[model samples]
Target: MTHHILKATKENVHLGGFSHLLEPALTIDSGDTIDVETYTGYYVYDKAPPEFLTPEFVDICQNLPPERKIAAGPHLLTGPIYVKDAEPGDVLEVILEAIAPSLPVGFNAIRTGWGALPQQFPQPALRFVRLDLVHNIAEFPPDSGIKIPLKPFFGILGVATPETARTSIPPGCYGGNIDNRELQTGSRVFLPIFVSGGLFSIGDGHSAQGDGEVNVTAIETSMNGRIILKLRKDLQLSTPVAETSTDIITMGFAQTLDAALEMAVKNMIDFLERFVNLSAEDAYVLCSLAVNFRITQVVNSPQKGVHGMLPKSIFSHKINL
Candidate 1:
C-alpha cells in the first residue's frame, strides 16, 4: 500500500459542507494510507488565544475566501479525496490508524440555542483547555488541578452526498459529524458510497468527549490522523457501520432518540442475519441478549444517533463477520 500526506490548506478544504460538485484534493488507490492534518473552529478562531493557534489554522481562518464558507454549518473540513475506482453502491472502509493533537490547546463551548440542554444554558460560554502533549492530558482550568486524559479522534469522516450541498452538522447514512467517542484509534468506519470516486473528507477534531456530547461540543481542536482507506465492494450497507477490536457497531440516526434507537437495533439485527448467517428470529433474540444499544449523540439537532454494539467475545469461535 502507498502512503500519502494531505495538509489542511485553504485550497484543499471545503468550509461547512460536503457536495459532490467539489473537486478532489488528492486521488489515491484503494488500500492507500493517508497521514492527514485537520483543524477545527474556523468560525470561532477570533475567540481563541493567539499563542494556542497553529499557523495553518490561522491561515485558513484569515485567508479563506468568503464564498467557500457555507452558511448551513461552521466546520472547516479538509478534502474530498478521490478514491480510485470507488463508485456508487460500494463501501469505503475508513480504518483509523492513529490520531494525535496538532495543537496544544482545544476549546469546548455551549452556545445559545445549541446543545442538548440549550434552554438551561441560555448564554454562550467558551472554555479553552491546554493540551499537555507530554502527559497526554487536557489541563482544564490550569489552577483547578483537573486533567482529563486525551483520546483524540476526528469527529467527521464523510463521503460526498448526492445533494448539491449537505450540511456538516448532522450525521447521516453518509457519516458526517458522528461524535462517537469510541471511534478512536483502531476503529473502522464503513460508509456507503454515493457519488463516483467516493469523495471523502475529514474534519472536526475532538481531543475527548463523553457519550451524547450533551453540551454540544467536546475539547474541539486540530488533529493529525493516520488513516487507511479501502474499497469494500464485498459489503453492502444502507447506513454506516463500524468495528473495533472487541465489538461490531451498527449505527442509526433519526429525529428522535427512541426512533434512532429503534433504527440502530434493527440495523444490528440486519447485520447479524446477513453477516453471521443467523435467521431473522435468531438475530432478534441475540440482540436482546447481547447487544448494547448506546446513545451516540443528541446534540446534532434533528439527527440524534444511537449505536448498537455487539461484543465479539460472545461468540466462542472466530468470527469474520
Candidate 2:
C-alpha cells in the first residue's frame, strides 16, 4: 500500500492546534505508515531570520488578537488518526520511524512574560539556532558560539481529550501536551482508546530542550517524521507508555507537583488495570512497584508538570505479547 502522508498547513487548519480539525473516522490501515510534515512550534515564524526584540515587538505581539498569540496555545497536536479495528478496550502502539528536519533553519523566542525564567531573567531574547540533523547538533552562544548535542522530541502527541471541546494546553489521561522527551524514534507510544480507532496525532517538534523547558521555549523547529500504527486488539493501556531506545516510560502532567504525580500515577494505574487486570488497589501497588516519576517542568504557567516512567525491564515477565 502507498504510504499515507499529510501536510500540515495554516489554511487547512489553524497553525498550532490542527488536531482540533481532525475527523475521528480518519483511518490508517494496519501496517500502514504515515509521514507528517510539522511546522515550528511557533508555526511559520521559523521561516524568518531572528528579529531583535524592541518596544515594537511587545506592541506588535500584544496588538495581536488574544487567540493569535503564540501562533496558538501550548501543545498543538496534528492527528486523531483512526487505526482500523482499534477499540476502546485496546491499546494503540505508535512506532516512531524517522525524524528529520523540515526546515534546515530553526529559531525560538523568549518574550517578556513567556517561559519559566521570564520573571528571573526579565529580559526578552531572540535567537537563531541551527539544527543540522546531518550533524545532530544545535548551536548557540555560550561564552561564545557553542554547539550542543541535539535530542529531538515532540512537545505534543495525544488521543483527543475526553472532553470534545477541551483546550490542548493541559496534559491529561488522553495525553495532550505531556512534553516528555523520551517519545523519540525507536520508541513505541501506547495510548488509551478514548474513542474508536484510538485517534492519534503528534506534533510540536523540538530540536533540543532542557528538562522543565524553564525558558518556556526550546529549540523549537519544524520536522518531518514517520510512524507506524499497530493495534492491541483485546488488551488496552489506560495511559500512555513508550519504549524508547534506552528505556520504557509512562507519563503524566498537571498544574502542581502533587497533582502531576497523581496524573502520572493514575495513568500507570490505568495501564495496569487494563494490561495486568489489576484492581485499583492492586494497580496502585503495581505502580509503586514499577513506576518512577520524573519532573519535566515546575515553572510553566497555570501549573507545573511531571512525567513518570517505568523501565521496560521493571517487570520480569516480557511485556510484549
Candidate 3:
C-alpha cells in the first residue's frame, strides 16, 4: 500500500458543497493511505484572532476565489480525491488511522437562527478555545478552568453523490456532516459509491463535540488525519455504515428525528440479517436487546440524524462481515 499526503490549499479545497463536477485533487489506487490536512469554518475565519490562525488557514481563507464558495453551506472541505477503479454500486471503506489537531485553537458558535434551541437563545455567540495539545485537552475560555478532553474527528467524510451539486450541511446516503462522536480513531466508515472513482472529500474538523451537537457547532478547527481507502465490490450498501473495535454503527438521516430513528433501526436490522445471516425476525429481536440508537445530530436543519450501535461482544463467534 502506497502512502500519499494531501495538503489543504486553496486549489485543493472546495467550499460548502459536493459535486461530481469537481476535479479530483489527487488520485490513488485502492489500499492506498493518505495523510490529509483539513480546514474548518469558512464564515467564521474573520472572527478568529490572528494569533490563533495558521498560515495555511489564512492562505486558504484569503486566496480562495469567491466562485468556489457554495452559498447554501458553510464548511470548507478538502478534496474530491479520486479512488482508482472505484465504480458506482461499489463501497469505499475508509479506515481512519489517526486524527490530530493541526492548529492550537478552535471555535464554537451559536447563530441567531441555528442550533437545537434557536428560539430560546436568539442572539449570536462565538467562543475561541485554545487547545493544550500536550495534555490532549481544550483549555476553554483560557481561564474558565474547564478543560474538555479532545476527541477530534472530521464532521464531513463523504464521496460525491448522484446530484450535480449537494450542500455540505447535511448528512445523507453519501455521508456528509455526520457529527457522530463515536467515529474517532480506529474506525471504518463504509460509504456507497454513486459516481465512478468515488470522489472522496473531508473537512469540518471538530476537536470536541457532544452527541447531538445541540448548540450548532463544535470546537471547529483544522485537523490532520490519516486514512486508508479500500474498494469493496463485495459489499452492497445503500447507505453509510461504520464500525469501531467494539460496535457496528448504522446511520440514517431524514427530516424528522422519528423517521431518522426508524431508518437507523431498519438499517441495523438489515445489516444483522445480511452480514450475520440471521432471520429478519431474529434481527428485530436482537436490535431491541442489544442496539442502542442515538441522536447523532439535530442542528443540520431538515436532515436530522440517528445511529444505531450494536455491540460486537454480543456475538460469541467472529463476524468477518
Candidate 4:
C-alpha cells in the first residue's frame, strides 16, 4: 500500500549483479510499490574510449564508477532490497509496471572473441545507437535509416543466496541475467527465496534484443523502471517463473543445452502440479501436448537458459492461487 522511491545513487549500485554478502539498499514489506532507476552494463565500466567518445558522453560515463568495483558484466545493478516476511522458503513476486530508457542514446557492440559469429567478426567493434523515445524507434548508426522498434526491459532481476559470490554473466536458479525478451511491461517474475528476507536486485536495461542476442548485446541502455514487490509466502519455488499476458513461463538454466532443456521440462511439470489438479503422469502429458520451449539466452557465459511457455488458456479452470 506504500510507495518506495529509490533514486539510483552511487552507493545504491553494485557493478556486477548479485554477491553473497550484498548490503541491502532498501528494505520494504510486501504490497509495496518500488520506483527504481538503473544503468546498462556499459555505462558504469566500459565507457567509450577517448577517440570514439563525445565530450558529453565521456563526462556522463566518468560520473559513474569511482565507488564500485570495475568488472565485466557491469550491469550497474540497483539494490538487494530486503522484503519483509520473505524467508528462504517463500517466493518473491515482482510485477513490472514500466521500463523505459533514461538516456537519449544507447549502444551495441561485438567483442573480438564473443558473439554467436565471432569468427566473422575477428576484431572488436562498437556503435552508439540512438533511440527516439517519443516515437518508440531506435536508429542505428545515427542515420542509417534503419529504425528498430523499442521494447525496453531489464536483462537482470534476481535475488542472492548464501553461497559463494558469482558473476552477473550467468543465469541460474537465482535468476541474474535471464535476458528473456518477453519480460516487458505487464509481466511478472516469481523468484525463489534463498537468504532470509530475499535480497532482490535489478539492472542491465536493454532497449531491444533478439531471441539469441547473437551479437552479445542489444540496444544497451540505461532505464528507469517501476514494479510492485509482493512476497508469496504460501508457495515455494525451485526456480524463477513468470507470467505474461498470454503465457506462464518457467525459467531453467544450466551449463549445456541438454541440461537446460531437462530443467525446463522438469520445471514445467512442477508448475502444472502446483497450479492444477493433475496427477504427475497427466502433467507430463499436458506439457507434451501444449507447452513450448524457448531458449532465453546463449550469451551469458558458463550457463544458458530455456523457458517453458504454457499458454494461459490451456487451463480449463481459473487458478485458485
The most accurate candidate by lDDT is: 3
Ten-residue region with minimum lDDT total, candidate 3: 65-74
* Residue lDDT tens for model 2, 172-269: 56665666767777777777777666667677787787778777677776667888887777555656677776555666666678887787788777
lDDT of 4 at 238: 81
In model 4, how large is the Cα lDDT of residue 36? 93
- TM-score (all chains, Cα) for each model: 0.97, 0.77, 0.97, 0.90
- Candidate 1, TM-score vs. the true structure? 0.97
Q: Global lDDT of each model?
A: 0.89, 0.64, 0.90, 0.80
Give the lDDT of residue 96 in candidate 4.
99
**Local error of candidate 4 at residue 299 (angstroms):** 0.9
Which candidate model has the greater lDDT, 2 or 4?
4
Off by over 4 Å in 1: none
Tens-digit lDDT string for candidate 3 (29-58)? 999999999988667888888755778878
Candidate 4, residues 37-74: lDDT per residue as tens digits?
A: 77664442355433334443344356655445434665
Better of 1 and 4 by lDDT: 1
**Residue range 1-321, candidate 1, lDDT tens digits:** 899999999888889899888878899999999999888888788888875577777888899876566537878888989999999999999999999988888899888998888888989998888888999997677878888899988899999888988899999999998888888999999999999999999989999898899999999988899999999999888899999888999998999999999999999999988889899899999999999999999998879999999999998776663
True lDDT of residue 293, candidate 4: 90
Once fitted onto the true fold, the runs of candidate 2 whose alpha carbons sit more than 4 angstroms away are: 10-14, 18-26, 41-47, 50-77, 86-89, 142-145, 162-164, 266-292, 299-303, 313-316
lDDT against true structure, model 2 = 0.64
Worst 10 residues of 4 by lDDT: 49-58
